[model samples]
Target: MSDVAVCSVVSHKFVPAQGMPVPGQVPASARAPRNDALRCTACSMRAICMPQGLTSDELKRMESLICPSRTIKQGETIYRANDSFQNIYAVRAGSFKTVVMHRDGGEQVTGFHLAGDSLGFDGVSSGHHSCDAVALEDSKVCIIPFHLLEAMCREVKAVQQHLHRMMGGEIVRESSQMMLLGTMSAEQRVATFLLNLSDRLRMRGYSPTEFHLRMTREEIGSYLGIKLETVSRMLSRFQRDGLVDIRGKDIRILDHEGLVRV
Candidate 1:
């Protein structure tokens, strides 16, 4: 069988599509059907993934360049460091964390990706991935081959502009993260992290005030450039101060303004 077909069969239970109810919202047996067909225009992530100002015909053309969406199970590596840069991926569902291995043989978590986020931009200059993209949960991603995408960008003005904007956004995000790690205190860093996650979740139609964390404390600390113990302590302090309610991995922001002040 074809690789795509095999992937579809293996991930039939969790194909990662829009409108799938989040965990705890409904029983698995009661969830709605998933759209297995890989059509860009029909995808719920169309707005986030597609180039701005594209017509339906243009979207169809863009879709034709993309390969079938592939599922990456939790803890699976999407791409390893130094892998050849052939394609960039769009998160169709779930989240992923990217890590860079240090010279000392330790690894540093560089960033976390959620649905609608783009991955593999780091390989643009070096022609190979600088970090590893690993799924934090069972996830799906639509693969956009780089060479075809580049050719299309030349023909489509909007597509080129969108690609530039995505690259610019990545630079800005990296700069902000460096500032956060270099300047912000531990509490401030954690506060910013929560607020950022909340904002991103809100954009995705999820409740900003309440949600479950996909990454563990160690992973979060690595991304934030802090110690795991410090993360735990700050979270406990936040709960004690009535800023949030934490139950295992679930978090509810009880006092958004209070958190903002921290």
Candidate 2:
């Protein structure tokens, strides 16, 4: 609701509220999870996207706080620029890319989000989204209605602190991107992208040395402020030098130290 999230001043007991749909919201093309219940403790992404200090009592309430997760197909827009900000979403499955289009029809890929990532923060300041979030694959997102979330934050100090930390992380990520685009060499940019993605996957309990790239070279180029040809060339060079093994979207980091030196 605000540029920076603040815990609500009014305190009330946390309650299990029903899902309140957005006006004219798009119907989910797929069904909700099996059994029609979500166990936050059992969720793979809880450690990444959820508050760490929630007691068992508090975590139970989160089942109702986050509405049934929605599954969107590849190429579907999660939220477009200018859409009203009603909820923030967490990726429960798959990945997404955020893009901004100029008046002249040119587009730039701003960021890539994988499972355990959050979306919709771009809308907080203006009450409307500033970019388009599109799934790179069939993806599912846990939607948290903003008003209810604000109320939860008011009564839960741990939840409030977690929200603030996430918001701060977003700012730091953007600033790092600025530095990447402004000063990094082409090789450094490409290397950093791979290393950064590797680190995230590792954090999410996936193999750090081997993973698939959900986004294409052109998409990576746009995000890195480089040409598509350069992206391809960099990958080719890395492979030739035995720094990495990349075939299509599948990549294996052959030499982490070698890549890092770039």
Measured by TM-score, the strongest candidate is: 2
Model 1 vs. true fold: TM = 0.85
lDDT of 1 by residue, 148-209 (tens): 78888999999999999889889988988888888999999888899899988887787999
What pairs collide in candidate 1?
none
- Tell me each candidate's TM-score: 0.85, 0.87
| Residue runs of model 2 more than 4 Å from their true location after superposition | 1-20, 23-37
Pairs in steric clash, model 2? none
Top lDDT: which candidate number?
2
**lDDT values of the candidates?**
0.78, 0.78
Q: Candidate 2 on 71-165: residue-level lDDT in tens?
A: 76677777888878888889998988878987877778888898899999999889999988887777888888776677789998988998899
For candidate 2, give the lDDT of residue 172.
Answer: 88
lDDT of 1 at 109: 83
lDDT of 1 at 237: 95
